[model samples]
Target: MLNKTLVPQSVARKIQGMIQTGEFQSGDKIPSQREFSQQLGVSRASLREALLTLETLGLLETETGRGTFVVGGKPSSSSHMASWRYSDSYSAFDVFQTRIMLEGRITSLAAGRLAASQLDQMENLTQQMEECWARQDLLSNVEADLEFHAIIASSCSNAMLRSLYQMVREQISETQRHPIPITEPARMRASIAEHRRIIAALRAHDGLLAQREMENHILNTARCAGLAP
Candidate 1:
């Protein structure tokens, strides 16, 4: 049974695990919300949230008249990304382009300013991202990725740049989560490697190299989301 205290993200991880282990095979229709809530020892509200999260991850699909089913084979990259919540204000492409410019400069400024503890935390979060992805915990993986980038932004020496990043934090976070559904495992591994390279550049106090690595990381992620060439 799932812990009563477990949030939607945690419950989503549990359901994702079941799918990964084939307990819920491809194309299998899952139980109803009432049944799932009872079985998982979670509230119906929590169950709904978890289901929505799984659907966004491309692990499940709900039909208009039928129940939800586990997705078969690889999820379609064309429609994998979750619907852009900020569409009313800006396009996903706009957000990604802005991120590349803003974060690249932030990383460069943070290179020599980050303390040892901040660096260590970034390293730990990167590791957590890998472990969470391996377990099919997409939400947690994205959370870890967010924190890893947040550390760099917070550590940047330029106060104005840091404030600008915080102002767009919501869009930045959405972009980070946007690519996960269609992200191949290989791309995830490459992203982890990119994080390591950025860390190395920061440790060496090489601002230019850190900026380059940061830009490349965002560009690669944008490619995964089909937002970039």
Candidate 2:
């Protein structure tokens, strides 16, 4: 008997059938998540999960600003799994590379300038992240991770830089998703530790060290995500 928990797989097979039957031919853009979920009577989360599987099977390819496209091929059981939630306009590598450049400088500028409230907020968020990690709750952890960086962006004293970073924030969130290898517990703990290091540098008012720490953290993250050397 099939497992009751295989909801996404069931959705995947249905979409696969549509591909096989030529309803969604090669090079065709599949329906949007909202449309698919509505048509299939399933949640958007489940549909997204199914699309990630299809992307791994090479039955679909997500393109920049082009939506998800059908490749019309058999699903490969051995294909690697990764998040398909990234921005279509920018690859994960592109987003993180930009982040490393911007955030490293931002952290440097924020050093010695952060208000007590800001530091307290960051400390609270970091604690929340650690607690979430202990509970194995990745989603909440990712939220706190984003918030921590956002606070640093706010502290940078550069309104334009903050605006630019905000523009790509969603793309940044995508990099935290699965198949990047950082989702593993050890890597997640390492990430939390890196956060602490950045915090320490900020507390010390050491601009250069803060910048270096932020850069190193981002580089390590990119490496774990398979986006950088």
Candidate 3:
């Protein structure tokens, strides 16, 4: 139980301590926001903020449908490993599992909301990815990849969804910081094709179609990462 006067940052640290001490193991679903709020005698808003802060720090993961879970590990010392150390705990599949849910919904919301300039931006990012792929520039490809997703997120009218996307995108960035073997030339090309389909769906302002296409794209990426069936 937490103190009634505990601030969110303090709550966050306490939660982190719990994970570090093995009180909460990786993949273990924690109490619901409401439950935690009551137990801590803290306002839900404070608790939510603390949770989101932990999420952004890569210490916990909040699945779209499922509740939050301890992400399993801390950042590593190795420069190349530090970014994605959280993956070792919950696994890449966990990230994709959540992404499929969040991105699919956000894409639907963004379908009818995207501006012409936003569409142009997505298209530009796609083109940049193509050039990066051609040059075997994984870093540039990753940058464009994140920007394309961020644009879709920004197009959505939901602030909560946008914040969630920002956090998830950060985690995705960690995963992308290193070149994934599964995303070789052929797969990168396939990703571009998938991006084109998603763009087409958005252009048509078909929310359902956009959602399906985005889900398909994410699922394919998850499969490539060996995180999906």
Candidate 4:
């Protein structure tokens, strides 16, 4: 992300806003690229970029033979924007199930592959999490949580496994903020303790323990974040 740009993010925002605000109803045909470019006061290139992003988001579906149309819209303000949600919020149970399946494999590899610097990085992330918890800041903790998991994901030996973990990290972080249990200090402290346990398991190079601890931690986090039944 540091090496990339968010310049074209605006096009996506406008299109998303239009859909969410009822400006573009589902299944409605959006203006042609040239027409929308003139209406939006943007270059044709920019409009195309925006539409392409919308397509990726599943909000707008484009057909080679037919014109583009709105397939869905963004969720309401009351809903959290899940990384894996397709315009709609994902079911907590389903999300957790997938996380267990996916992160289980990640921890299995990370246990043996974690390097010295990587351990230090994870420790640093843990410290940051503690600081955020002391401040009672959910957003801060979520950011640090993502950093910690990202370090774990990056350490796994397989490139494909690392990529999959990265993708899951997005959804996990996206769901991290404002979970029901985040309102309580006890829940926060428990989370920190669980993190410490997981880190210790990784340090011991116990793959089975590390994997179990990782899975338990994720399930606990999801529950604390109001993402579980």
Candidate 5:
């Protein structure tokens, strides 16, 4: 039965709890709305509401002729390309290529239009990155790293370009989750320094130099992470 006090909580939270407890797993069929209503002592309407909430959050996928399925939650390159009718699977290189195109335009636009305040913002984010690296805060380093790049892209005067970069931001973040081994400390330091240089180029409205520095920074990161030749 539903607790009187806990009833104040949203239905989505209760359903989220069920998923976390492994009441259902990937590819497992969830109970019907009627069954859930009886088990949880809630109305059928409440149970349906909960299911819709879960569906909206990407927790379940429904097929036309079949019931909903609990697809795995782990994100991957192939997972994002499920809608693509490919003769073969997409590769990490495909994603890198797209990033190169997307970020290249963003850097070029940012270079032409960055304001003094935006330069200061990039500098601050880059400084945070250096501190995180020196302290060996690997996760923080990754977050700050992404944020600094994101800040640069967002500062670009072109709204459409900024939106496109934000759309693929999650994919880029996921792909960059590799461990930064301490064996190559110089790579990280050089990457951080390049960020400052790129900011200076943008502040000067030097489009070519800013674009080149930004491209070199990403390529160097890929190489350091052993994702490049």
Candidate 6:
């Protein structure tokens, strides 16, 4: 049984390990939620969340009237991303476009204003993202990516812009996670390189360069999700 305090991301990692290690083969129908939850000693809600995370990472596929199945081989580019939960309020493309504008400005404002500790954490998180992706730990990879961006946003010198970012953070986060399922390996490597470029700009106190790097990073991510040209 898994630890009681484990979050869905941790549980998702466990299930992902099972698939990678052949305990759950490609195209195998996963056990039903009730049985799986009991087997893992996790609550149904937690198990469900874990399953959804794996599904979003293209490690699992759920079909109507059919149980979830492992996606054994390389995940297809056609595998769908998690449905935009904010559809009624905003489209995924809308959020991506806003991020390119808003985050770019925020990152520009953050230049030279971030604490050393914050910069160090961003560097660490960027490294963690590379490690997580190598291990196929997609949930952790995205979480690290989120924290890396959050550090830049929180460090922005403009309070109003920072406050506005906070207000729409949920949608921003969705856009961050939206591309993971379809992100190819080369693109992921490029993203890591983009992070390094942004960090270099920030460290050099080059606001314009930081903003450009941030915009390019978001634009590339949107392209990965097929939301941008």
Listed per model in order, the count of residue pairs whose N, CA or C atoms clash below 3 Å is 0, 1, 0, 1, 0, 0
In the range 21-119, model 5's lDDT, one tens digit per residue, is 677777787777688678878877766655543453345556667776665332221132222112155445555666767786789888867668777
Clashing pairs in 6: none
Q: For model 6, how does the per-residue alpha-carbon lDDT over 26-120 read when each residue is reduced to its tens digit?
A: 87999999999998888888899788767766788888899899885343433677667689999988988999999999999999998888888
What is candidate 1's lDDT per residue for 83-136, written digit by digit as tens?
676899999899999999999999999989999888888899999999987866
lDDT against the true structure, per candidate, is 0.85, 0.75, 0.72, 0.67, 0.63, 0.85
Candidate 4 off by > 4 Å:
1-89, 178-182, 226-229
Output the number of the TM-score-best candidate. Answer: 6
Which parts of model 1 are misplaced by more than 4 Å?
1-6, 21-23, 31-49, 65-67, 72-79
RMSD to the hidden true structure, all candidates: 4.1, 10.3, 12.5, 9.2, 10.5, 3.3
Q: What residue pairs are clashing in model 3?
A: none
- TM-score for each candidate, following the candidate numbering: 0.77, 0.64, 0.61, 0.60, 0.57, 0.86
Q: Over the full model, what C-alpha lDDT does candidate 6 score relative to the true structure?
A: 0.85
TM-score of 5: 0.57
How do the residues 58-134 of candidate 2 rate in per-residue lDDT, one tens digit apiece? 56778879799886543222234445455467777787888789999989999999987888888888899889767
Candidate 3 lDDT tens digits, 1-229:
2443247757776777777688898789989889988987878888886776566445667778987887653432111212244655666667777888888999999998998888988999999989975754444566688888888988887889988988777566544432243355677788899898899999999999999998988888776555572
Candidate 2: pairs in clash: 64-88
Candidates ranked by lDDT: 6, 1, 2, 3, 4, 5
* Winner on lDDT (2 vs 6): 6
